[model samples]
Target: MGGSFGANLRRIRDESGLSLAQLAAKINYSKSYLSKIENDLKPPTADIAKRCDSLFGTAGFLSAMVTAGERPDGDQDEDVADDEVWVMVAGDDGERRFHRLPRREVLTGVGAAAGFALTGGARAVVDEPTLAGLRTMFGQYRLLGTTSSPATVLAPVIAHVDTLRALAAAGHPESVRRQLLLLASRAAEYAGWMSQEAGDERAALWWTHRSVAFAEAGGDEHFASYALIRRAEIAMYRQDPLTTIELATLAQADRAAGARILGLAARCEAQGHALVGDRAAYRRALDRAAALLAEADPAVPVLGSSSVSDEVALADGWSLYDLGRPAEAAAALDRQFPGITASARRARARFGARRVLAHAGNGEIDHACELAPAVLADAAQVDSATVRVDLRELARVLARWPGHPAARELRFALGTALRVRPGSGG
Candidate 1:
């Protein structure tokens, strides 16, 4: 994989008529380092690949090459060994520590059942009131997630899932057990999203798989399809459009899936199409998603993002940018972005960053710069990794006009938001 990436990089660089030194200068890498990468003596990083892709106008080819090569071993499955356990401890300073450790170490002298107990007393009854309270708490947690850093929300969400699982295993009524498991699955799913926001893709996949396991244990087979959508989202972030499309298509294959799930899957499929520059397919998928969403029952439990009122519209605007219709993208995003609630800091940051990118891509440098400060503020508040993807691209776009004062200022502000050195291909 490394050899393939290196060869491709060299081929593209040569085809573009750039010397090693010239390419290195453009991408902020040392000439010697670029040479080593071209020779396959050193592996490429995702950052370097993105820089080269932006420089060479290869869409996401270089980034996809890096993603394909860098995927971790054992990332395709959601299996946990029986001999392993997740141990969490709460401290007096309101900090929680979590670790996955060998079961033998923690259960040395204690029986496995006793070791897994939440407390040293008779089991607490899993009742309606408790379940209702937990459900309400989960809703609150979801709201908190939108505004707080994922790091701030992840520990409690995981702890809640563990509690729900423990309650479900306490020989409760079948109905109660199923509800508990389903709720646990939901929390676990949210944990997966937060994990992604925290920039740990492997952990995000693990939690998503765990969500599917929980849902399956509760006899809710529909969640497995939704889990595919989640995986598709991760693939989208990796710039692997083919995998994104495949996973999203599989997600939509379950005819029995709810309208909301199908709609979300279609939205993801549209993103996949946009990534590959398939404008017609992207429009079809987006239209399908929008119709499904409109026909969906609002009383049904929400699956994906709850903040965005019109996800398909926002996605259409987002896809337009990827389809090289930046002026149209800017207009569409401008229409939809304001509908997002101010409290949805993460969502606002993500879409707002894209809107700024669209403006920049349309050569509205002053307008892009004018819009950036607020988006950067929201991005910093949320500490979002996804938002930084666009910000990095914005930095690249603004770099083309280093002499323009507003562009230079915006670039420096972007560097600050991303916590990288200015003009360093953030």
Candidate 2:
């Protein structure tokens, strides 16, 4: 149904020779809003369908499409079946396969269970194998977060979280129930992180809150503290250093937070200090974090298999960059980045963008320009607002040398990187 509606709408809109913005203006909507509908990221409402019908003189044809699309079997073209939503479902042999189905079908089937889960209804039994499968699926989704854009993975992550919550409420042994809750918390935390990267602050906050709740319910104080630290990270990205510092401090105050979480909180605090140009405080915070990180117990697991020392190093590099010590920043980042795998798309993109900024800061305009394209290429793979912000700032610096050939080329690249082209809306 999504495929059919999107295809039909795009065809009609193109044939009518109206750009997305033009039609949106006629219909009293934003181009980005309409683009989401046309791209299947959002379902068309009856009002939108009616408006489209009137504009194209289709005599309610578009409205009918909307109505049909609400049904399970509506306009499902087999030729484009491959375009349907697919989710990873683990098999008995430790393999996973894509389970393709119409969106409506999956939603309808899962909604009741989700509601039951929320209401604490009578437990429904699920076997051990099924539980393992669900855990495997969560692991797969978490792995994807490193490589895929948030927009590409957000829906599936949400769906998986919903399913996990439902399973949590179902009949299970106490131990299994606790395990399920832990997975749900982790899922919510990942979703929150993704939302932050995608620039959805409210959603990120909401998901992070949910994560903390679940983690606490599961008696995982470490994860709860981690969620607060994640929230601090979000504040930092938004350039709210005060809020970042406050949240980081709050997380550190949690007695249950271990050495690794303490290190994370300290790192967050250090970033805040760096942002405000408190060199002494920043250095003290970095040293404190490094000390705690070195003493973190090996038994305690941090999210994403991240090493405390590695994280502190990256944060220290960022602090150096923010404090306007570009050469030192470059040296620090150069030492750290090679240890980061190419598969870690978000990390690599972020560090690479900062590296470009470091070069530009040191008056190495040509070198910066030489590196910008590759950095942007990798950064484009993740829907990370933080990376975009860094690139934009670098562009502003490059703007000072407008006539320089390298600067000009970089500006052209920035225009392409930053602008929202037709059909590629937020």
Candidate 3:
């Protein structure tokens, strides 16, 4: 369903023999974003669509999105299409535009990871054009998630980012380039998410590093601090918790950034604490994450793991769940989902898995089993490996009840999923 868009985008761009960073320099999109659109978890809007076709000379690259049947029919009535669009650091209004960006076959925790990599709501001095265009871009993409099909939903946002990178490379003044460097942090993070979501880890890490570089280039201490946290999460999952703890502490030292940044630093440190089984310290860090999160403005849009106030809430809840606080974890996880623009999609496979995890933590096995499928339609959705950490635990929880059909079913599914992850021999 992704329509060879990402592959085609990459082939075309790379055939030109340009490195992602080089291509990004030419146009203005972050190398990471262009990398994602080429991979497909995200689609492009007409603005971006046209830009790609123009740059790569691929006609109909964007045409399909505009002509697709996935557009939501209901929001045609929500007249506030008036939100501003942040373009290369300039803030302006979002347009009544249409695009034909390619799509992902599914959505999953990949976005969660990307969300983790982005700015954690603590504001930064951004590039102007990007600021103007981003306002509309963010608002539109949120709605797009609810409106489009798996084939077209995410790509547009990624595509927009790709286009911005393209624009950034067009050689605008240092002012514009500087702003894009800031936006590039967000774009690259999204690119990493989309690429990882599409199951391309090499691309994911590439975007991730590039994002950190962008943050650094822009003199963006805040963004750089945030990117480092994402690296910590990557290390945590790989089970290299020492590195996770180190990176998390590095971010913690940048407290001058703001509450959201400090909150993320605390969250990352807490994750490391849980890994080391330092119960007391983990609890202390968890308490700090909770406090910083509680006092912050929920709507300012902190990107990634710290984006929404409820984001830290969700992460804290999951961390606690991982640390074995079933009751408390269930309670914390419940504080999230402050309502994505339309809200019905969570009933899908990926979100369902997380839902199942929380339900299980609350001793609701029946409910827990239910979350396994709705959101995980594609094993590859949350990155080819088993990105849903809770599922890895599902096998254990269900094994305790070996005879139930539901438990048996969960066990079989989890076992198969385990083998797909690169080194998960167990």
RMSD of every candidate to native, in Å, equals 7.3, 18.5, 22.2
lDDT-superior candidate, 2 or 3: 2
Off by over 4 Å in 3: 1-131, 138-162, 294-301, 305-309, 331-355, 358-364, 370-387, 412-426
Candidate 1 lDDT (Cα, 0 to 1): 0.81
Candidate 1, 137-198: lDDT as tens digits: 89999999898777678767876777787678879899999999999999989988987887
For candidate 3, write residues 276-351 as lDDT tens digits. Answer: 4455667688789778766667676666632232555566665654444455655655455433222434223333
TM-score for each model: 0.77, 0.70, 0.56
Q: What C-alpha lDDT values do all the predictions have?
A: 0.81, 0.72, 0.55
Worst window of 10 by summed lDDT in candidate 2 = 74-83
**In candidate 1, where is summed lDDT lowest over 10 consecutive residues?**
106-115
List, in order, the clash count of every candidate structure.
0, 1, 67
Q: Write the per-residue lDDT of candidate 2 for residues 326-366, one digit (tens) a residue.
A: 66777788788788887787788888889887777666788
306 Cα displacement, candidate 1 (Å): 0.5
In model 2, the clashing pairs are 124-171
